[model samples]
Target: MGAATGSATPRIVIAGGGLAGLSLALALKRALADGIDVTMCDPALKRDPHGDKRSYAIAAAARRMLTALGVWDRVAERAQPILDMVITDSRLQDPVRPTFLTFAGEVDGNEPFAHMVTAGDLTAVLLEACRTAGVDLRPEGVKGFSIQGSRTDVTLTDGAVLPAALLVAADGGRSRLREQAGIGWISWPYRQSGIVATIAHERDHEGRAVEHFLPSGPFAILPLKAVLQADGTLQHRCSIVWTERAENVPTLLESHPEDLLVELERRFGLQLGKLAFETKPQAFPLSFGVARSFVAERLALLGDAAHVIHPIAGQGLNLGLHDAAALAEIITDVMRLGLDPGAADVLDGYERARRTDITAMGVVTDGLNRLFSNDVLPVRLIRDLGLGLVDRMPGLKRFFIREAAGLTRQEAPRLLRGETL
Candidate 1:
């Protein structure tokens, strides 16, 4: 159940089976010395089809991680590359959505800035890769755990006990393991809700993504693969992340289908042609949260467990994927040197590498949500002008694009660089 210090193959128990946990398992399985054991626990993994029917904007860095993990082949066919992006600022009733910024989405001649991938597709592929890599997938949640010298004993919800050289808490924003470890966090509920769903459009999106900043929040139109409708005809489809005031979201969610479409059309515009719901809409309350520390003894937090930011930039998942690669790289490097994977200094290295990036992203997303989610004329004018100025400066625009693509940092993990661990 556990590895002896500095000798036996180390055992790593990850307490979540979402993208973060699975990716971590796969990364470790590929990087660690042979015989190392990786186990992931989450009841949801038992579901035949995982995910809530939403799409994610996968940054270039994340795509590289998927490629290095050898799962991108399965994900690539279904992925929709975002070849361009248009940013605008206007009210819902405005006759025009003025483009204040535009980006040519390719980072290099070969790579696009990002791709739109359904959550289900990505998770299924990652899970299969984890299985192929020999990760022990447990269909039980982690109830809690206790850290002893050189070993951590985990308690599963089914009352089973397991031991590992290191315990990872990837259980998400409301991580029970994190709370049990007494990790403090900073959190604030935004008075907004992100309404998500897929819609069929009359015209092709041609791989362009759009973000319209409104008084309530940002409405993002992300491209998705065409799907066969009930009539057996292939229809163009797109994903929508429509943010509205928190108080107004409930009413919107409860509104009649016809009425909801009217409101949607108000913000969505007719740029992509007529739109109809391809899937029922869902709403998630928006919030900003960051754990005070990313590591605790034999445990480390990943993904939403460590930080949760506004959906304005769609960088949440990418950040967690980065954490998985970084942590895996750090642990495997030390282990290759005959050092303990759970050594305090090894964990400290992971924290030092990720904390700054996480904090910077949190600040950027929070500032964007505040600056653009208001109706004040002066503020709007200033931000719009700033956006326009950035758009005009090719060098500055490219810099921002590279940052969003997750390539600006020089000390990133191997997977982020499209290299194997």
Candidate 2:
């Protein structure tokens, strides 16, 4: 029941209109001249309630990408730059249980490592840009997909079949279109759940972010600017990314708001004031997932569809944004040059350029997760030593800070270099 993309302006079909999908559409529309066509399918975006629960820690490069797409300034008010990040162990019984770590953000130059922005604020700005650029927004989700001799046929939940030069699968993990295209993913559950919530504090955050290492996972406190209540009362706000064991997640969510805040306060220490304003809490199972291949005959997997890493580094969304920016650049350039948008050469080039970065990040994040999540004595000794050495070595620490900010050297795209609109 879908409309076939006629020999129109190199029509690119994107599925899943969350951050990655929408951002890709907006970025492509801006980068491509001559009315490049884009279509995105997402159903849940318009119906999101209590959008306050979702947020992200976007790297400096990701912010630059948004600025190039003309969406950053629109949502800047809701974002808080991370002035500093402090890491330490969660051993109260053994005070020095190898407790040590490094600090990023502000340590380099005047710039913070990244900005923490809520998903709703980001999506609102992206959606507006997509509309202004005349990109087609499909309300129905992708239900199925098929590959013909030279084309890809995408079926939506509405029963419409649409043809595309390239089928982009941005649907989250467990994508139906990826499976329909016969693409398989490699995933391992960490037996962890990410408990996300927003808390109002009595003291100013000073734009500092904190990450605490515990047996469960990292407990991250991300600063956010003051929030305006319905009645116009200003409140200091910060987001908590608390990772807990899967079995314990249910109990934690069921815990009374007061008791949960108390536990968080105790675990978080008194550096910041006590947590007061508690929003509704939600949790999702955590895992490390990567699709073996990023592309097929006419289908390409992106965002969570391609890889999912630990929340410890808060790189999951940043990685997803990177995928969006990279794919958009490659696809738009090839199409503008009058080449086949989904040609084997073009797609292969993209695959080759992205593989190295994706693999390296996946390995680094996985290694960090394994190292920090475990409480083994040897790991404690080695990681603590590693942390201390890295902390003292300014050069090595700067290298990591640069890497974390997505400024590492590579043949990065122009937009990836923090291009401003």
Model 2, 100-138: lDDT tens per residue? 765757534687779988887888778878988888888
Model-by-model lDDT, in order? 0.90, 0.79
> What TM-score, computed on C-alpha atoms, does each candidate reach?
0.97, 0.93
Which ten contiguous residues of candidate 2 have the minimum total lDDT?
Answer: 1-10
* Model 2 residue 13 CA deviation in Å: 0.9
RMSD to the hidden true structure, all candidates: 1.9, 3.3
* Candidate 2: Cα lDDT at 223: 91
Query: Where does candidate 1 have its weakest 10-residue lDDT segment?
Result: 1-10
Off by over 4 Å in 1: 1-7, 228-232
Highest lDDT among the candidates is held by which one?
Answer: 1
**Candidate 1 residue lDDT tens string, 77-112:** 989999999999998888877899999999977699
